[model samples]
Target: MAMFVHLTSAANAPGVRRSGIRAASHGQGSARGVYCFPVLPSYTLTHQWLRELARFGSRGGLVAVHVRLDDAQEVLVGRYAERARMAQVVVSAAEAVRRIAALEDPRGWEVFVPRAIRPREVHRVRTAPQVTGWRYLPDAHGARPCTCFGCRVRGGYGARRLRERLPHPLDGPPPPVRVLLAQVAAGDPGDAAALREALHWFSMRRRGPLDRLAGLATHPDPGVREDLVWAVAGWSTPGVTELLDGLADDPDADVREAVEAARDPIS
Candidate 1:
């Protein structure tokens, strides 16, 4: 048998002890399962998820549930960063343990068992140090964070403050429509960076001088043209739809993708 540990809320301890750790999806897909880490010789490494899980504000603190599973049992394993993309592979329980243990830095690794752990498979539920693992990402301390709108969650802890400290070029409150138009008009078409920035500001504000901005559809830089699609996506003005329809056939894949994303309400 291979040993593994699952960190969960202490509030569920009674139910967990009465039964076993129930299988549930961790926002990846419809496949419900219990998540665990291979038990390593190093105590801190074995419980590396404790601190990260606590960030979710688990009530009553958290506990570690040790489990035993057959070495031949199949499980899904992948890097924590790829979990949202469902980029995992099926491997035997023992193989998962060996693979993680062999990694020089196994900080972001995770395993997903496809079924509930039976009571007999549970070894014990015990108290764990609340501050044992890396938060955000492994070794993320002192690393510059990506403050893009997609990277930082709205209203998340420290998100507002972090954005204020380090604003992303493509994020934050956009300038007024008139200001963006003047910037775009005065910007050198050869200067892709400046043109892209002004266009991106228009994208954020979702309104601009459509006729003036539309001329950039033929800009040499595909990035500028891509930003053009986003800039006009929210416009209800006449000729906007026709302009977007023309952009839909852009030779650049990124520009075409931007056009498709712009047309989709949920994209």
Candidate 2:
């Protein structure tokens, strides 16, 4: 599977690079090894990144910055960009001015950076449609708060920071699919984390039960689908192969990426 990042002046540049996404994280990436790549864009792009990040229990967000870009900069992406695990955009100087003027979101914040950082790597700025992240498994911590790396870092204020409040996330891995789905539907802020844990747990089950859960791929929740896609990525089962192949055109872009990322290089 190819890990791609979008690069440009403001990280939205037209430069698309095929590179491996490093798993190194300043904080607990997730109980499930959810990783994130900085991407470019405000609305549509942010959701895609967050959803992808959320699947692995890693958290991501978008922040808007005012910056100038070279003429060759890009403002949009093709299918590959949509399939990217991480994407960035660099609007040309002209496009930046136009977007800034045409901006419709009243709450967008401006980030003032030092002169050195501002001009050098404007693409590295972390932008978000919203901010959210989940921590390690809850059971491992042995506390109601699950004081694992995840809870300690973000103080559970990640996805919760969005205007649409989430109830909270799950506490630990579930033994099966129904319980997993219920935990997800509960709408916990840690829902993503729980999904990660469940993914980790499900991968070890016997073939019979594991295949049963795979059939639930039709689940409507994007969160569940995100979790499902990443959960089955590395498994060696006939059903898993078909499950990924069938998701090629999933309505959700992130789901499709998960499927693509799960494919074996030689397959």
Candidate 3:
């Protein structure tokens, strides 16, 4: 049998003891399973997922549930990111341990059993240090965080504070609407860039003095009109619907396409 450790909330200890570890899908895929790491020699490595799992606001503290599976049992093994891409390789339980143990740095590596673990397979549950292992990513301590919209989920724990501390260059907060309008009116060589930036900002915040920008609908630049479509697409303002209707027939093919995309973003 190959030994592995699964980290989970201490609050679920009673249930786990009663019914083993239930298999569940992480996201929208067929990769439903219990995620565990091999029982490595290093105690720290064996419970490396403790801190990261805590970040998800697991009820109470965390515990390491030791489990044993047949060496011939099939499992998926890969780095956390590779699993999302369905790039994990199918391997025997014993091979999974051997591969990860041989790696010099197996911080984000994981083994996934595609079904629920039975109570007989569970060896024991023990307390794990809540602070053990890394958060965010392995070795991410003291490193500058990427504050891009995709990387930093809005309203997440410490998300706002982290962005405020280390804001990205292009993804940082935009200038005031008045400041953006001034740059647009100047009509300098940089006006197009400024206008595009302003539109991008407005897209995220649909509540703005959009009337001031109504004139841009016919602005000589077709790109500006296309961007304006995107900016007001989600707004429920009185005239926004009419504005989008008019832009739908724009002479420029790109502007028409933008209107379509804005109306049905899923496509």
Q: Please report the candidate that would top TM-score against the real structure.
A: 3
Write down the TM-score of every candidate.
Answer: 0.59, 0.31, 0.60
Candidate 3 per-residue lDDT, tens place, 136-212, comes to 78988788778874456545789778888998887768777788777667763347777887887776554666787
User: Candidate 1, residues 10-89: lDDT per residue as tens digits?
Assistant: 88788888899777655457676888999999998999988777765566788999999999999999898788877888
Q: Rate the local accuracy (lDDT) of all candidates.
A: 0.81, 0.39, 0.80
Report the number of backbone clashes for model 1: 0
Please give, for residues 39-104, the per-residue lDDT of candidate 2 as tens digits.
235444323333223333221222333233343443322122232333323344344334443545
In candidate 1, which residue ranges exceed 4 Å CA deviation? 146-160, 167-267
lDDT of 3: 0.80
RMSD to native, candidate 3: 11.4
Which sequence of candidate numbers ranks them by lDDT, best first?
Answer: 1, 3, 2
Against the correct fold, how does model 2 do in TM-score? Answer: 0.31
Considering TM-score, where higher is better, how would the candidates rank from best to worst? 3, 1, 2
Question: Which portions of model 3 show Cα errors greater than 4 Å?
Answer: 148-160, 167-267
